[model samples]
Target: MINISYDIKEYRKQLFDIVNDGNVIVELGCHVGNTTKLILDKFDNVKIIAIDNSPEAVGKMEKLADDYSNLTFISGDVRRHEILLEAFRLTQSCDILSVDLGGGYHPDTVFKVFYIWSSTFKPVHSIIRNKGLVDFCNSAVVGCEDFKSHEGHLESYIDEGIPPQIKEFELWTPSLREK
Candidate 1:
């Protein structure tokens, strides 16, 4: 969800907390490499496969990639086949899948993108930074005592992952028995 914090330290902590021992990280949006840079610097062993739709300045990403031997930056649209193919060719899987497409990331976009990334990589952990996600988080009432997270959530599914099926996506549905 959107790192809903005004303080920079709190936001950074929230983002970095999800990542501890993960070395190979697939970052969906590295618009400026700010977060990517932090990640690379934080973990000495971090290898970031960062992608961005923008290659704004000439040699911007190329320079960053050149500087960091551990980094592999791909420039393209995530929804495109070429991008997907390139990502697949780079690495079939990663330890973490970090998606921060943008601050105003719509839930629909997040769901669609995460569906593809999660299904493909099957990372040990995954995280999204989206403003809209905060709404869903706040709307919910549940345990906050750290139920096994990330891939661990898969075992407990609904209990840990919260609702994979959100109310926002529902308009009508087939019923085994009418409501």
Candidate 2:
């Protein structure tokens, strides 16, 4: 969901290892079921609670969920707490949380969603795709705009107990869900 990706397949492939470790996955932004298919195809027993704001996207998810009884797709704006609560009503806990709001998601909004979801579910794994946060984190240039704008919050998150992890591939974010 980063701002740019030349090879979508390679960008999508980076998620293979991160999504490999969980059973109950809480996913945000199931656009056309690209990543959904990935998780479904990789594991037979995994249960996914997927959310999206677009009815079209949710419709696609519905079709994908046809063969998989384990998947629960909810059509709603994932940025809303109500939506989170609704999803939570279906499952008390989560094992993994994967978020891909696509390139249009603002960095701050993406981080806020991540923080809330991580706090709520405390998943064993979490992945996010955002160009802003990624740019902020990886930039080494002193006073780099991204770093200056996002470093404080990033550090604060770590101080508050969510240490950030850098991915080998910039298009994807991979983090170990902390206890």
lDDT of each: 0.65, 0.64
Pull out the clashing pairs in model 1.
2-130
Q: List TM-scores for all candidates, in order.
A: 0.71, 0.70
Instruction: Tell me the spans in candidate 2 whose CA falls farther than 4 Å from its real position.
Output: 1-11, 140-179
What tens digits encode model 1's per-residue C-alpha lDDT throughout 1-179?
22333233554577698666446788887787877778878887777888888767226776888888988988887765567667867776677777777757687777566656655566776777666766777787787766544471132332222233543322111120133
Return the lDDT, model 2, position 8: 42
Query: Which candidate comes out best when scored by TM-score?
Result: 1
- Candidate 2, residue 73: lDDT: 86
Total clashing pairs for each candidate? 1, 0
Candidate 1, residue 4: the lDDT equals 39
